[model samples]
Target: MGQNISFNGTTGVNNDTERRIHIPLYFRILSVIEIPVMILTLVALCAVIKSQRSAPVFVIHLILSDFIQIICKLMITSEWIREVDAIFPILPDAFDYSLIAGLYFMACVAFERYLLVSHPIWYKSHHSLKVSCVVSVIVWFVPLIFTFSKYFDSLSVPIGCLIPYPIIILCFVGTRRGLSHAISLTSLKRKLILGRLFLVLLTYTFLIFPIVIMWFFSQIFPQFMFSSFSDVLYFFSHLMFLNPIADCLLYLFMRPDAGDLMKSVCCCCRTDTHQNSTHSRDEHSRDSRATFACCVSVQNPASHSQTACSSV
Candidate 1:
């Protein structure tokens, strides 16, 4: 997932020296933060999708990709289990590729949202869970091409950076146009949805573009590959992992059913409180009525007697 700054000399002779320089503290901190964030993001995504069974298929696929990515990142950071890499030779590539796949999957999600809003009937007729599943599989496949190819492995990250520019731009533009033409939704709701999309796009670009630009230059300017510069690059590179966390927050803020999703996630806690409040209110009303009835009977005894005499 990152260039090991701790390693010195050639790959073969570097293992023993690795113990001299542990992974950077900042990298460790990012990895630790990511572990819990990834777990919570996975939980939130699953909860959201499960309760809202009609959620877009792309959402499900996106979460699945993130789940895989989190696992890979976890492995990458597992310093104690260095032997795992030996057992799983593809871990590093898998980690990088999974992260790259996420970018593509997100692009697909934007495209899906555009279609759903812009051309609902056509999207509905053509869309299937199976198609989403297939697309998810395809997104992971591209990375494996570079994973196994020796010549391409070195250039994979830079190429990944370059490859998705057009897709991302096209999807961004299409999403904007779709929102503009969305006649089915009210102005306020459409504006909110468009705003959400814009935030997601902006956050993604901000996080990803810096690393891409750095890598682009590192290819041409070997000085950009110095350890000091590499350290900075590593920091930004791992920051990409924060995208899933941002994404979950975006859903919480933007989705119309966010409150319902929260209640669903915390339904176990809400049920008792709701029931207790309703029961307490009912009991209070019943007691008040009983007290009122007793007071009325006492105060109206003379009237009751007159009514009895009239009846006789």
Candidate 2:
């Protein structure tokens, strides 16, 4: 009777089980290092918001997403959670979703900077805290949809990952072009915007793009690559852990205090004495002008003094 009631062949299931790879010691070590960094980043972000009395809405969301991703990664790599993951395999999906959200938030930040540079008036009028909050909410939800759909269709995951790359590149290019023509933003402001955009682009290219490319290829040729190159894909996926650490640099770039510190450190060769000397020269020039005006006023009568002082 048991033989008569034949189940689906066991060969595919056995093959899949064999293909399952264990989390390496290196990834676990990386996760241990990442947790403290993410915590410090979160604290710094909150401190910046509190001290400045202004929240960088997109950056806040991006950091939150990174924190979530790091937590999910730690959960996945933890030995204690193996049984829970087997019972309910949701942590991996959660990690993927958080990663996607982080990508979107990065794009949002780049686009916001681009708007500020390219269309200052429009950005000033239309871009408000409320609008940013709404946009961040929307960004958070969009990934859920994609991650859910990814279970039904493998291609959806890669497509979702691929979408942000071009948006970021376009923002970086637009910002570079606008910086050349921008008159409203100061040199330091323009430099910060360009630097942030460049950093985002670089992060995506080096740390995130490899996993995306491997995922895309594995999805496209699942039978061939997924079976043959599963270990390679797993190795590339671990590279993503570096992203949250790299993201701390964004906070440094965003913080005014950090930027000032960086400038001071870079210009440490210029002595305080030189600055005092310049200040003294400026004071002497002002005093000389005042003396010249007083002499002119004294040389002329009251009626002519008004015209003479005005001319001086």
Candidate 3:
């Protein structure tokens, strides 16, 4: 007597023990495309950070997460002998959790910007570098716990969706509000930053939603998990990986300072190095003189007395 089995509607002649997990060829191809894009994004982000004196810590964290995800994806998509056991026991879970954690960081960044622009006084008073570092640790750690838990897939999904999705929606609404109220040059710049951020979030959400929907269905109906729909899921999964590269491009175009840094690296319209050095020194001296003048004005008792008298 013989028993027949099928998985995802595809029938194959193999014993239960012979059945093994395998990655599709197309999925592996998509990963190959994603890897180079991520590498380029990482390089661009590094260049931006190097040139900027006060780059956001979140950007650094985002890049690190992207790098880790790329590595994990490579492992997942690599060609290998399929065994009844997991090919790499840890890569799949790590990939999902790390990606989700990175999404949390992106949400935090959006929220921080919203606060900074909408409530500048409060943001300045409450924001701390040390506190940001602590929060980053918490963000990365929270997802890992779920990944390692017995209910890994079933439990992590809803929380992952709840946290970042609403936060990003709030960020979107808050930024719009901030833009409407903004009048000053600085405020306008903040609006631009928020606009770029909104684009990044929106793009990420759109690309990842297909996978989320598929995952939601899969959890409830395990039979549907790796069906024909999986081919579509793989495409979206690759698109989701493109978010980091999208982020880099968005930063380059939307942030003027970062654009200038990239341009400088490309040596666009290059001038003589000696002339550039001389010009920088001159600019520094002019800034120093202006600062000294401002200090002198503040130090003058006569000016202070005159202003006090005039006010009265």
Candidate 4:
């Protein structure tokens, strides 16, 4: 029997156990790696919160969006595998907005980095806390304006929610282009480092570009044209979890300060670990030496070397 993804086209789409669930192997492979990705997100959020880092405020939002995505993925895995209800209830689409907020934060982080790197003076002079507060309000409110879908089933194009998208694309592209040109005149080693960072930023935008196209197509083709692809679109949306790895890569390669800090932390951890191991070995050796010395003292009843014996 040929399978279709829609169920009466009213509220829910019945995804094919074979087609939809077949899930391109790439996606499945990526999904398998999400556990550590989820953990990294929690740890990163906590670390950012405890310490006042540049753009730490947006880190909370980014982590939250990724967290929501992790929850959504878990739900998808469970709901699909368990085969519960065969149909999900129509619920408030809070996750929808949250995912968009995630994209917004992704752009926010990129530009934030660009500003700090390319125009530190301008960012410090103008992009202060007051401006950030206003900018955040704008980011949140724009999405709310386009919550046109009454419920999950009737979900419509989130039109007003995306006005900032072009600006985001521009900011990402412009920043990269500017950085590339500036780095070109520099030494080869610096250019290579900058090249790697640019690729990381480029990949971040690459993951985001699909959603932007989805929005454009939803507007152009009308809902009935292809609603079945929505869930797949939703899944592709979660791939931003890879951003942490990308962010870390860029940090290790491009940002010397961040790389140094990470190196220091890792070295400190290794040093502590090594010291603990060394101390344990020393303790064991000391105990053996003491036992042997005591035995010798008892047997020999007196040794000139006893004076040299000492407890560490």
Structural similarity to truth (TM-score) of each candidate? 0.66, 0.75, 0.64, 0.53
| lDDT by residue (tens digit), candidate 2, 89-162 | 67767777888899999999899988988888898889776898999999999988878886577667667877
| Residue 91 accuracy (lDDT) in model 1 | 62
Clashes of 2: 0
Worst 10 residues of 1 by lDDT: 5-14
Error of 3 at 105 (Å): 1.3
Flag clash pairs in model 1. Answer: none
Candidate maximizing lDDT:
2
Indicate whether candidate 1 or candidate 2 has the larger TM-score.
2
Provide the clashing-pair count of each candidate structure: 0, 0, 0, 0
Candidate scoring better on lDDT of 1 and 4: 1
Candidate 3 vs 4: which has more lDDT:
3
Q: What Cα-based lDDT does every candidate model obtain?
A: 0.61, 0.74, 0.62, 0.52
Worst 10 residues of 3 by lDDT: 1-10
lDDT of 3 by residue, 1-312 (tens): 001111111222331322223434444565577667657766676676556543465665766787777676666545452242465656666766767777787787787778877887898787776767788888888776656662534645435744687787888788778767877646446545666677657766776566566656555665654435655654455467666665545545424374456557556445567678889999999999999988988899798789889999
Error of 4 at 174 (Å): 3.6
**Model 2, CA-based lDDT:** 0.74
- After superposing candidate 2, which stretches have Cα over 4 Å from the reference? 1-24, 85-87, 226-228, 269-312
